[model samples]
Target chain A: MPLSKAQLLAWLGKLDAVYAAKKEYLTDLDAAIGDADHGINMNRGFGKVMEKLPPVADKDIGTILKTVGMTLMSSVGGASGPLYGTFWMKPGMLLGGKEELDAADFARFVEAGVDGILQRGRPERGDKTMYDVWAPVLEVVKARAAAGDDVAAIVDAALPVGEKALADTIPLQARKGRASYLGERSVGHQDPGATSSYYMLETLRDVLHA
Target chain B: MKKLINAVENVVKEQLEGMALAHPELTVAFEPTFIRRADAPVAGKVALISGGGSGHEPMHGGFVGKGMLDGACPGEVFTSPTPDQMYACAKAVDGGAGVLFIVKNYTGDVMNFEAAAELVAADGIKVQNILIDDDVAVKDSLYTAGRRGVGTTVLAEKIVGAAAEAGYDLDACAALCRKVNQYGRSFGVALTSCTVPAAGKPTFDLGEGEVEMGIGIHGEPGTHRMPIGPVDALTAYAAGQIIDDPAYTRTVREWDGSGWAENTLTDAPFAKGDNVIAFVNSMGGTPLSELYAVYRKLDAVCKEKGLTIVRNLIGPYITSLEMQGFSITLLKADDEILKYWDAPVKTPGLVR
Candidate 1:
């Protein structure tokens, strides 16, 4: 089955809830190497996304995603705002007026969003950023869609790839973002950004499977 | 953990409200938070807009007035303000000339301000974004976010703001801002960590006998920690770091008329006999007497290093909440910089 607009909205809702629950955990991870505000920032951004979703509920998926991006851009201060804001906004621009996304469409959406992150953050793989998760996940999604898998199966395959990527972020010294300031110290701690990115992917999977 | 506030979530809003009430000359806006001069969009002059995290009191916002920044955006405490705030602020303050964004070197500040500049440019308004990266603590651009913009930001705002007040256009304002950034260098030592209201805990823990050397303003861990010592010894260490630092080179991104362009910039090291502006700034918790003590040693250190202190600014102008520490900034000044420094200025936090 193709992923519908309602499922996308549910994914956003799940993301909001997950971030709220994991705020302290993500923040503690950041505190180990960063400024200790990732959880707070993400929670605030997604909370704002939730508030904006109701107004755009009847709109197309592209419009809904664009609204999420715009809200995050305006409300979530810091690197995540522009990085993740573009993450959604770029894909939304490509997905304009789409009511539902087939596996191929979803793959295109993820690829465009990941490309936006790369453009905005200039993060490369193993730089210990959200891109670490997105890069591998994008690869899996593209491969699965090409194999004629549905959106659900594609996301299911991408989730474990994202999970492994998130785990791999540990033991890698950060070369981007505030965590990079810690130098070698950034290595033992799991990257908060990667963790959050994994949660986002996981949320999408849950919404799609349901 | 004990901070004077109504609630953690309401901290930034409440503080902004208080500032609006206290500083009638400055206009504060909510929903998307920004503070600007009451008489903003000044007839034909360039508008200076700068912003960063909120905990740094009186910076960005406090510097908004006749001879300084035309507008300032305050993000959540210790977080960079969003692009929308900058876009709205640019719209609110862009005089006929143009708007220049004075961005700090932190990733969040740089990215958000860049986005805002693009938005402003797309609206048919002329815009430029210049970066300030003067902290000498971080040694390499190959790793980390290059050098973090520290005490020099305050100096840039004052000096470049004065030039803008004296009729420098956007390009000129941006040029002078960049020059100030290049000529200035800073080093900090933190005696303690500060508590973010929302987090309700100190960002880091520092033992009583230890101090965080080469600390940034955000309470993040410094380059290294060492045994704490007397005030004179600590002051000398901080001053020596700035004086002895080698030249720094990095590539910075600026918005041209059309798009973002990369520019390789280098900050030359301070030389003997250089005329300098010495700034001894408290990191919030440190008091005036402690700062005076630091300045006394800093003045002596510069003289010993064959540098001349032509002028000085001593206070908590740029701070990181109530963290008990201080930073030293040395600006190698030319005649033009000196003249601008001496220009008359009036704002809620500064008066001359």
Candidate 2:
């Protein structure tokens, strides 16, 4: 099944709630490696998104997504600001005028979002960044879409892999962002960016299930 | 947990309001927050804009005034301001000569400034970026996200701002700024961790005697740590590392007219008889008396190494909130740099 504009808004709200609940946990993880503001930054960004979202809730998914992107870009303010901000803005621009996203369209949307991050952040996968989680989840989505799976099934299958990918970041030494400063010390801490990316994917899965 | 704040969310805005009330020379804009010189759009001069997180007071914002920064964007505490703030500031301050962006080498600052530059350029305004990455604590780009731009940022802003006011065009100002970055080296030591108001507690804990060495300006842990040492020992350790450090090489991104351009730059090691400006900066909570003590040691080390301190500045100019710490910066000064550094200018944070 494809997701409507309402479902998409719900996904955003769900993501906001997830960040709200997990902000401190994410911050604790970030404190281990980063400057220790990931949770606060994410909550501030998503909280702004929730506030600005009401006015555009009736808008098309592309317009709605663009609004969220701009809000995140302005409010988030760290590496994540431009990284995740562009992630939404790119797909919002690409998926313009679309009423809803089917499984294949969703896969393409994810690719465009990742492309935005790649261009802005210039980070490679396995750098213990958000790209690590996004890259693995993207691969599964692409394969599932190519195999003709629907959005619901593809999301369900990808959630576990994305979680594993997030877990996998614990052992990888950071090579990007502020956490990269820790070098070997970064190895044992779960990557904050990766965890946030997993939360994003899990939001997608739960939205689909509901 | 104690801070003189109204609320966590309102801290930045209220602080900006306080700045506006105190400094009438600055025009504070809220909504899309930005602070610019009241007499901005100084006709025929290239405006210089820079900003980073809020806790570093007297930085990009407090420095915004005549012959210093034309404008500064302040983000939430310890957060880089958004691109829209930069874009708006650029357009508001451009004097038809162009605008030069003085960016610190943090990933967030770089990305947001890049986006703002693109936005302004698409609107037909010329903008150039000079990235400042001068921390010598982090060894190389391999282990860290590259060296963090620390105390040298303040010196760069003052020097580059004077150049811009003296009719050096955008390109010339950028060149001078980059030269400053290349010639500058900084080493920081944190005696105690700082609390970002939103975080509600110290970023990190130090046992009774533990101290963080080589720390970045954002209260982030340094490259190493050791038990607390005497003031002279801590000062010597930081200065020794900087004075004896090897050459540092890195590739950084800057903007040409059309696209992002990469420049490979190097930090030449300082040697005997090298004329330089020595700066001892506090990370905030440290007192002026302590900084002078630090300067006392630094001056002796420079003299012993035969490195001439042609000029010296000490105090809490570029701070990282109320963190009890210090960073030493040494910038190799040439004739041009010396001339600009001594130029008369006025700003809230710096006056001579």
Q: Model 1 segments beyond 4 Å from truth?
A: none
Tell me each candidate's i-RMS in Å.
0.8, 1.1
DockQ of 1: 0.83
Tens digits of lDDT, candidate 1, B1-352:
7779998889989888899899899899987889999999898999999999999987979999988999999998999999999999999999889999999899999889988988899999899999999988898998777999999999999999999999999899999999999999999999999988877888888998999999999998888999999999999999999999998999998888998898999888999999999999999999999999999889889999999999999999999999999999999999999999999899887887
The positional error of residue A106 in candidate 1, measured at the CA in angstroms, is 1.1
The digit string of per-residue lDDT tens for model 1 on A19-121 reads 9999999988988878888898899899999888898899888898889999989987789889889999998999888999999999999999999898788
TM-score of candidate 1 to 2 decimals: 0.98
lDDT of 2 by residue, A1-210 (tens): 787787788899999999999989988898888877899899989999999998888778789878988999888888999889999998999888889998888998899999989988888878999998888889999999899899888888889989998888889999888888878888888898889988988887888788
Tell me the tens digit of each residue's lDDT in model 2 across B99-174. Answer: 9999888888899988888888999998999888888888888656898888899999999888888899888999
**What is each model's TM-score for chain A?**
0.98, 0.97
